[model samples]
Target: MSAEQGTHTHHDDRATVARHAVAADAAALDQAQRTASPIAGRAAGAPSGLDAAYATQHALIARRTDRGERVVGVKLGFTSRAKAEQMGVADVILGTLTDAMGVDDHGRYDPRTAIHPRVEPEVAYLLGPGVEDELAEPDPSASIAAVAPALEVIDSRYRDFRFSLDDVVADNASAAAFAIGPWRRPADTGPMDNRAVSLEFDGRLVQAGSTAAILGDPGRAIAAARRLAGRHGFALRAGMILLAGAATAAVPLPATGVVGAEIAGLGRVSLRVGDGARTEAR
Candidate 1:
């Protein structure tokens, strides 16, 4: 055969190898999920589970993509030092985007679909412009413009609501759904400044926290998010929602309960959890 023909054959072989690698990764993840067995970096005493977690998230994203779902954006979690400590980790993790994760402003969420669902009050940022460059410069302010108060609903498929950092990472940081509030434009305020927030369940106050709880300032969490995305060759884009991690510990959502969050400068967002709806455990 001619040299061009040999090159084509080599290319085909490489493509086949790549396909098998991807298939093997997917099969491993499927086995892990089914048997509740930790794989790769998720194993006990692993330094961090970021790799294993990202792999699993990528698998899920690929599956969604195969089903024709558009990826809207990414979400960051565990930015709060307190939360990291609570989860026994130092850094944050990322989750893939999906249309189904969006909840209507006043919609009801069922608790049956989630393995273990939990609620966290947070401040989310909607990128008005693309941050492709800023994601690499090691500073978050250059890429972000506005911020908003929001809540993240997280759930993990693992049993007992307990898992190692790698396990959680492999599980997409336990992110299930999110509810966002009105945008606080021109987030010129310092990224590290503290802002008070209150959460109410069924019209009664249940918890209160400060944005400072999240990596000293919610903006820093945004910066961390940008950095994390950069590591994965992705950028925070315009109109994409960036969840700056939870401001306080996540709360367990019981079936048939109404949840509300009020950020000092940002407005309020509320949602109802219904029976048969799935939720993450705190």
Candidate 2:
């Protein structure tokens, strides 16, 4: 074969390998989610880099979108500096959120929907129209229409919830489900930073934290999301929800009970598990 022929053949071979790897990763994760069973043994085909990991993530989320689940927003992970430090990473991660993942306030979050689920407190932002235009501005949080108290359920598809950064990224940041309370105008909510936060299981306080734990201010998460979305070549449409990273450590979701999170001045949001269920300083 000529030299040009060999180069083309090698390129095609690499492309084929990448496609196969992404398909396998997506299939494994999809099956685990659908069966509510965690997979053991991270295989050789698992994504080994950020690009491959995110490709797997997109393919995984695409499976649900193809099944009619609409993407409603995005969720961030490891936004807390302390948590990032703990994880030995310098940056945060993000995951897509679909309509299927949202549990209404006071709505039930079926434990059978996830594998080894855990819950954490978060601050959610509602984006306004033209928000995408603000992504490059000095303050991207200016795109926020409102803020709310929220909870995110994380269930790693991997056994024992053990995985590397790339592994978790490929699993959609371990995102399983989420719930948001009534929206409060950002003006009415006061500073996004330093809001007292708490999570309760059946009226028993399970965890407590502050919105300041979310990258020093939950609003900053929007900026991070904007950059990440742009880097991934996805648009952040108006009306999309952004769940800032957890403000407190996650606790295992109870088999059955009411899990609630309250943000000072923002109000409260809750999820009912079969019952129901961070770190920081940016």
Task: Tell me, by TM-score, which candidate is best.
Answer: 2
Per-residue lDDT for 229 in model 2? 84
How high a TM-score does candidate 2 get? 0.94
Lowest lDDT block of 10, candidate 2: 273-282
Rate residue 140 of model 1 by lDDT.
61
Model 2, position 114: C-alpha lDDT score: 87
Residue-by-residue lDDT tens digits, candidate 2, 1-282: 999999999999989988888988898888999999889844467648888888898999999999999999999999878878988888889899999999888888789888899999999989877576843573644688888899999999999988888888889999999999999898887887898999988888989889888999887887788889888755688899999899999999989878888888889988777832311111
lDDT of 1 by residue, 183-280 (tens): 66655444445888888787777889888887777777666777787675454677787887777778887677778888776677877789643332
Winning candidate number (lDDT): 2
Please list the C-alpha lDDT of all candidates, in the order they appear.
0.69, 0.86
Per-model TM against the reference: 0.78, 0.94
Query: What is the lDDT, from 0 to 100, of the residue 38 in candidate 2?
Result: 87
Residue runs of model 2 more than 4 Å from their true location after superposition: 41-43, 275-282
